[model samples]
Every structure is written in structure tokens, then in C-alpha cells.
Target: MTAEHGPGASDIDESRIPSWIACEDLLVKMREELIDRAIKLLNREIESGHIAVNGSTLFSSEANADVEEAMYLINNLIDDSGRLHKEYSEYIEKNNGKKLSDAEAKKFGELQKFVLSVEQLNMLMEYARVLSSWADAAGKMIEGKDTEDILRKTIDKEELRKTVLEFFINDSECRVLLSSKEIEAIKSVLGA
Candidate 1:
């Protein structure tokens, strides 16, 4: 059996195989399974209307474009995460039952960390969805009430807008992890 690295060890070389290839394979498989579960959770949320784009006057064509761009980023991130998980799994399976060096063990640890980050990004996407829904609802509220009154009554329109922008930024970061090409595509959409 290969020795397990402590959670605090951050110097694991992901490029090298660890002493226990079997353990690495198991970790890769677990990452893949977690990715699958996250995807399922996202889909279920969308289906259940927990994550939805409400129809509101606030959902202007321009805002919709931004929202769509964010969605694109989120989807691409999911795809990249899934692909990486598959590739890592394949690599492990090809060398099943073999002993890996410390360097290799480090690489596996890094892969696991990447998987965790992807999961965190997915959670952020869910947050963005909720924010989008709120904006839509708020826009509807504004449409019926005085704009000035609504703006004043609502404690933080600016903060809400900033949150939306931050969501887009987080989405962009996820895409950048996938590919420079994807990052460029997102930039083009944002006119940035």
C-alpha cells in the first residue's frame, strides 16, 4: 500500500506516479464520480426551477447576452473538468497495479486538487444562477414601481450589480483553466 500524503502537503508532483498506482486510480475515479454528481446536481436544480432565468423587464437583450456568455463559460468549465477526469482515469487504468514514484504520487494529488477546484467552481455557478434570478425579479419589481423609489428602497443595487460582474469574472477564470482559446472567446463576448 502507498502512504497517503497529509492534506497540508502541497508539493506533490502530479507528473510522477506515486508508489501505489491503485490508490491513484481510485482517486481519479473518485474525482470523476464527484464531477458526475455535481453535473447531476446542476441539472436537477435547473429542472426544478431552483436555478432559472425569470422573465422580467430587467432581462434586457444586452443583459441576456451577458448572462448567456456566463452560461457558456460555466458549460465549458464543466466539459473541461469532465474531460480531464476521463483522461486522468485512462492514464491510471493503462498502468494499473504498477508502483509509482513520489513524483507520480504528487501528480495524482494535484489532479485531485484540480477536481476539488472544479467542484467549487460549479458551486459558484449555482450562486450566479441565483443572482441572475434575483436580478430578473428585481427588474420586474422596478418596472411596476418608481425607479427612484425602487433604487432607494433597495439597499444595494450597486452591490447586486457588482455581484453579477464578479460571477462573470469567476466564470472567465474557469474557462481560462480549460484553454486560452476559450478565454479569448469569453473575452470577445464580453467585449473585454
Candidate 2:
């Protein structure tokens, strides 16, 4: 305890809560942007049809780079990832099975969420598939004397996807813990 700091010290200067990392949220945005840019490259030359999921076909627009549904699922995943990370931080607060300070606990809860259920991995995979379809279509349209320049855009898009996918794959609670088959599906779509 310090005097200038509240009761005793003349040395303590600054203290503040650390910011939480929202990698998942940013990654979702990156994914959406990649699709959007790809669509622009090809002038929105895409198709629409029913999307097949888990051995069943769901009627939804198959293309045009509209990734609203994908975004919804990704946002849920971001929340879930935040909650999971907070859970670990909270767990670490317990020393030898003894509960820590109420302030710490409260902060953890505030930083986290009660709804812990994550977005379905299959749905995320489907989103990746849709993105890949758009990418493939857009890739074919790269032309003109600026072909090399446009191809760079494609490279950047894929790189962003890779970065996002790696984020999920590196987190055990997010996507790394997924089944091998499901992981393969994501990789195929991401061209990883």
C-alpha cells in the first residue's frame, strides 16, 4: 500500500486493467472482407442454390458473396472464444483450490459471458466452403495487363483466411479440438 497510491507509496505511478484480445472477432471481419474483395474482383459473377450441410440440403442463396449467415456463426464463435479464454484466466485465479478475490472474479465474469455454447463447427466449415467457392470463381476472372497486381489481391485474401484459420486451429477450445473430418473440411475450403 502507498500514500500517493492510496495509503503508503510515493512510487507507484500507473495501473490499469489489461485489454482482452479479440482475435476471433477481428478474424471474422477479415474473412468477410476477403470474400467482399473477391466478389468485387469478379464483378459478382457467382451462383445461388441450396447449400448442403451434414448430409442434408438447406435452401439458401449459394453465392454472390453474401456472408451474413457466416458472420453470425463467426460472431458466436468469437464470443465463445472470449468466454473460454476468460474461463482459463478465472481458473488460474484459484491458488491451491482456494478462491481468489471477489474483484478478480467479478472482472472475469464481466469480461466473459454466461452463454458458453460455441457455434457449430460444421456451420463454420460450410461458411469456409462458400468463401472458397467465391474465391475460385473470382480467381478465374483475374485478367488484363494488371493481372499480376490483381493476383496479389487474391494472395492477400488467402493469407488472411490462413491467419484466421490458424487462430481457430491453435485454440483447443475453438477449432483445434474439432474432429479430423471436420478439420479437413475447413482446410479444403481454405486451401490450407
Candidate 3:
């Protein structure tokens, strides 16, 4: 039988779930949640015995190989996502521990850190969204069902895209986070 991921083997016990995260370290917390979600998504597929859908011999070598391949890909994607966050942190540290990057970063002046924090959070959410999309596809491949609910729970697409725009484009609190000039650099960095 394929293995179920997370605490308590046969099924995940809800008590072992991580606590409600605080906004202080939102980006870091998101990365952790994203990884947990990917694992859970894949495990659900395994438990459903939907790893291979072509009616391939459930207990055959081919079926096992298929499951292994899927697991490898998901694991790799999660690893890369974590690596991206690590690299971003290193980039910030290398820039004199200034979360806002160099003076060319933007024009928040006294509020540069706050503005940059929002930007960085947006980037992390975008990354999580991509990973969630992959998980959705994986779910489809296994259960052959709609993944709207799963995707929503893992990463809110509308919030990631639209809400961020509103926060950056209109919200007064976030208005000074980045100056007009710095936004261009952020756009380039975030590939907006």
C-alpha cells in the first residue's frame, strides 16, 4: 500500500496541524504551509489509489514507478520553492541587511521596510500559487475531480493577484511602501 504523509500514518491527525500563524513572519509561514499542502495533496492521491489512472495493474511495477515519479516531481517542486525563499533572504542580507535593497530599491524613505515587506510577501504568495497549481494538476491526475476547493484552501488566486494590485495601487497604508521609481525595479525583479 502507498504511504500516507504527515503525522499518524494512516491519516493525518488534525491536532498535529500547525497553529494559526502571525503576520510578523508571514512569508516564512507561507512557505511552510505550501510545503505541507503539497505533501498532503500527494498523499491524498496515494491513499485514493489514484496514482495511475489508466487501470495499470495497481500492484504492478509500472504503477509503483508512476507513483514514485509523481512523488519525486512534487518533492522537487517543493524543494525549489524553499530554495527560492532562501535565495531571496540571502539577497536581502547581502544588501547590507536592508530588506529594501539598495537606495535604488524605492522611495518609501522611513517606511521602506514596511513597503518592502509587503512586496516580499506578494512574491511569496505568488510562488505559493504556482506550487498550488501544480498540486491541483496532480490532484486531477489522481482523483480526476475538480480542484477548486483544494486550490482555494492552499492559495487564494484572486487575493494573490488582484488584492495585491489593490494594496499597491490604491491603499493609502501601502502607498508609500515603494516609490514610483522603485516600483519599476520591483516589477522587473518580480517579472510583473
Estimated TM-score per prediction? 0.31, 0.24, 0.23
Q: For residues 127-168, what per-residue lDDT tens digits would candidate 3 score against the true structure?
A: 566544444433433322222222233433444533443334
**Where's the lowest-lDDT run of ten residues in candidate 3?**
17-26
Once fitted onto the true fold, the runs of candidate 1 whose alpha carbons sit more than 4 angstroms away are: 1-75, 86-99, 142-192
Instruction: Predict model 2's lDDT versus the native.
Output: 0.39
Tens digits of per-residue lDDT, candidate 2, 64-163, equal: 2245544443444455656665665565455334564888666445433222222234234444554454345434543412322222334455554455
Predicted structure 1: clash tally: 12
TM-score of 3: 0.23
Native RMSD of candidate 3 (Å): 20.7
CA-lDDT, candidates in order: 0.44, 0.39, 0.40
Q: What is the lDDT of residue 94 in candidate 1?
A: 66
Candidate 1 lDDT over 58-140, as tens digits, reads 33478566455445545766667678668766775665566778897766655555555556666655545444444344444
How far does residue 24 in candidate 2 sit from its true spot (Å)?
25
What's the residue-level lDDT of 121 in candidate 2? 40
